[model samples]
Target: MAAPTSEPGTFAVTYRWGLPLDEAAIAAVSELTCHLLKGCSPGSSCGCKVNRNLTRLVRQGVEMEMPDPTLIYSEGRTGLPMADMWLAMVNPYRLTSPSRVYSPDFRRPRVQQWP
Candidate 1:
């Protein structure tokens, strides 16, 4: 099992494969993560924080083979039970999709490196 390493102010959610991904969802998360990571201003819409380590910006949802997961928080309005249901099942390769994928910028609190 992946141990929880959520920072005190960080929001987190799991992303599993074979799930439907919405463009709006992706945009919303990308903005949130980038803003929270201090990459961009609250007034500006910066894309998801780029994981300079991986040399790519983390998106709303990732592929199954993605080894590291980003931060994901549930939207207050949309009560998608998808995460709960997904957590119950047995899927080892599941990808954790937090509402916002943490910025991969080295200075941020949650940066990931591929093993």
Candidate 2:
């Protein structure tokens, strides 16, 4: 697998295998990303944080196998249920907008003098 290249605030995670990723693998990647983000310091960019940890996981013995959903269920196995559900919930709300913009309005302050 190729190493991930990320900018200061942006990260790109790529799966190098020619095959599509399975749900379990996707879930694992998601978990890994979250773990990294949680450890990031305040004011650190999230993308960079996630990418760093993902690189570690990929380096580890985690297989990039893409398992079939049907096969997983056929054996009456609940395979990575929590991650799957969390992904389902988070996917829809993933990128509605860019980062929040805060505006500042500066005006002369009104002072009341004692009568």
Candidate 3:
């Protein structure tokens, strides 16, 4: 874990496992992003704020790798700070948003305990 956000369960982690980085692997990575975005306390003030473009790309039925070398993106509460760091490192010249995204304007997903 690089650094944890204000949320107790959220952290900025860099997973650099050595592999061929195939299309299947990229799909799995994208799915992991989805999981992290969906993993949040329901009805809590700290919820996930997902990127609609990413979701749309996922829904498009096309399999392609993300261009950025950062590999992972954290838009929700779990990885907001990390996301900022990512943007700064990747594109420091570009104007980026701040930490005003703590509360997602949408409802969060409810995860149930397994039997």
Q: What are the RMSDs of all candidates, in order?
A: 24.3, 22.9, 23.3
In order of appearance, the predictions have TM-scores of: 0.21, 0.23, 0.22
| Candidate 2: tens digits of C-alpha lDDT, residues 32-102 | 56756765867766443332212122436665554555565464433455655655555645454566755
Q: Which window of ten consecutive residues has the lowest lDDT sum in model 3?
A: 69-78
Candidate 3 per-residue lDDT over residues 1-115, each given as its tens digit = 4445766777665787776765544555565566565656455343344333442235468765433322334322223444445545545665455435556777778999999
Candidate 1 Cα misplacement greater than 4 A, ranges: 1-18, 39-115
Worst 10 residues of 2 by lDDT: 48-57
Q: Per-residue lDDT for 30 in model 1?
A: 59
Candidate that beats the other on TM-score, 1 or 3, i.e. the better one: 3
lDDT string, candidate 1, 32-86, tens digits: 4545566455544444444423434556775333223232333221112343333
